[model samples]
Target: MKNKPAFATMEALAAVLIIGFLIVIFILFIHPPKQFADARNVRRTSNVGTILTALNQYIIDNGAGPPGVDGIWRVLGTADSGCNINCAKKIPTGIEAAGCLDLTPYLVPKYLLNIPSDPKLGKPEITYYAVRQTINGRIEVLSCGLESNQ
Candidate 1:
C-alpha cells in the first residue's frame, strides 16, 4: 500500500537523523579542537618535568650546579643561524631570555639520553625550554611553548 512506502521513507529519515546526531556528538565531545591543545600542553609539561629532573639529578650527583653559576636565565637550545659561529651555543628566542646553556655535556648520555625539546616548534638544536638558577641556587626549568594557554 502507499502507507507502507511512506513508513519506509520515515524509517530512512529517522535513521539519517540518528546518524547525524551521532556525528555531532562525536565531533563536539569525542574529538574537539581543544583536546589537541590540551594534549600538547601535557606534552610540554612532561618535557619540562623531565628537564628539571635531569638537571636536579646532575646537581645531586656532581654536588654542584651544572652551569657552575647562579641567578642567570640560560636558554636551552642552540643559537639560531643568525649567531654564525656561535650556532653551537644557545641563543635567545621569543620564548625566553638571552644566553644559551647547552646542557648536552652535562645532561646528555648521563642524566638524560639527550635534551628534550618542545612538542611543537622545537628541534634538537633549539629546545623550546629554558633553565635558570635562582639567586638562592634553586634550579628552575620552564617550557617556552605551552599550549592551551596554560
Candidate 2:
C-alpha cells in the first residue's frame, strides 16, 4: 500500500489557521481588556483625593469651608448636579460666590492649579459630588464613577 502523507495537506493547514483566528476573535470579544477601566478608576480616585485634601487645606486657611450656593451646610449632591446648590453653574473662579459653590479657594495659586474634571465629564451625567454634612460640619467629596467599593 502507498504510504500516507506524514504532514497535513495545504488545504488542511489553511483550515486550521482559520479556526485558530476565529477562536482568538471570540476570546477577545468575550473578555475585553480591563486596563483602561482600571486606569480610569485610578485617575478618578486620585482626583477625588486631591480635591478632598485641597478642601481641608482651604478650611484650615480660611477658618471655614467654602460656601455652597444653596447654603453653608448642605447634603451631598448627585453626580448629575454636582453639589446641591448651583450644579449647573460654571465656576469662573474658585472663590466663594453666590448661585454656586466656588472652589477658587482651592484652585488659585493655592491648592490646585485647575479643577480636575471627571474622566467621563460632559457626558450628561454627574460623575463627582460634594456636600458639607450638618452633623459633623465636614466637607464630603465623592466620585460616583469610582470602580472600587472602598
Candidate 3:
C-alpha cells in the first residue's frame, strides 16, 4: 500500500509537469515577444529625427527650403511609377514613395549621405513621411514615421 501511494504521487507530479510545459509552449505561440516591433518603432523615430535635423541644417545653409511649388514635397517616389515629381498624383502614404524627397539641392554630399528608408521598407502601409511647413517665411521640417504609431 505504501509503494502504491508513492507511485501515484510520482505519476501525478509527472502529469502536472507535462501540463505546465504544454501551457508554456502554448503561451509562447499565442503571445510572441514584441521586441522586434518595439525595436522597429525606435528605429523609425530615430530616422525621422535624423531627417528633420538634416532638413534644418539645409535650411540654415541655403537660407531657403527645398523647392516645392505647393509647399508640399512628398518624400520618396510615387507608388505606381516610383517617380518623384513626375507622378500623376500624390499619395499620402509614406512607404509608397520611390524616393525620399526632391530636395536634391540639399543632398549634395552635405545633408545626408543617403535617405533613410523605413525599417519596414516593403510594408507600404507604414513608412516615413515629411512635410515642409512655412511660418513667417521660415521653413520648418515636420516628419512622422509609421513605426512611431505602433
Candidate 4:
C-alpha cells in the first residue's frame, strides 16, 4: 500500500511537469511574443507610407521640396532640446548626421493632419521617423525605430 501511494504521487508530479512543459511550449511557439512585435512593425510600415504619401503630395502641390530636404536623412518631428536643426544624433543609426526636419508647418493642416511618429519611441521632439529625398527626386520615409530584429 505504501509503495502504491508513492507511485501515485510520482505519477501526479510527472503529469504536472508535462502539463507545465506543454503550456510553455504553447506560449512560446503556438502563441508568441512576436505577435506584438509584428503589430508594431505593421504600424511602422503604415506610418512610413503615410509620410511618403504626404511628402509626395506636398511636392506635387508646391512644385518643390519641403524645407531641409537636401538628400539627407532628416529626423521627422518637432525640433527642441538644444538640437534645434539637425537631430540626426537622436537616430540610432544616424544615417545622415544632419538636421531634424520640422514638417509641421508645411504638412500639418495641408498635407497631413499631423506627422506620424514611430510605433514605439515616437515623440514630437524626435518622432523616430526619418525622411530624405534622393537625387532622382524619389522621396523616402521610414521608421527609424523598427523592432524585432527589423
The clash count for each model shown is 0, 5, 5, 1
C-alpha lDDT of residue 52 in model 2: 78
Say what the RMSD of model 1 is. Answer: 5.6
lDDT of 2 at 68: 58
lDDT of 3 by residue, 1-150 (tens): 335455578799999999999999877875544666677667767766776777778778877666651245455422444423232222344323345455544554688776666676523322344444455654443334343244
Model 4 worst lDDT window (10 residues): 80-89
Displacement of the residue 43 alpha carbon in candidate 4, Å = 0.6
Residue 16 miss distance in model 2 (angstroms): 6.7
Taken over the whole model, the C-alpha lDDT of each candidate is 0.71, 0.54, 0.54, 0.77
Deviation (Å) of 59 in candidate 1? 1.3
lDDT of 4: 0.77
User: Model 4, residue 107: what's the lDDT?
Assistant: 90
TM agreement with the true structure for every prediction: 0.75, 0.55, 0.56, 0.75
Model 1 spans > 4 angstroms off:
1-7, 68-70, 81-99
Of models 1 and 3, which has the larger TM-score?
1
Which candidate ranks first by lDDT, i.e. highest? 4
Write one digit per residue (lDDT tens) for candidate 2, span 14-62: 9899999999987787544455667877887787788778878887888
Ranked by TM-score, the better of candidates 3 and 4 is 4
Off by over 4 Å in 4: 1-19, 81-93
In candidate 4, list every pair of residues with a backbone clash.
86-99
Q: What is the lDDT of residue 125 in candidate 4?
A: 74
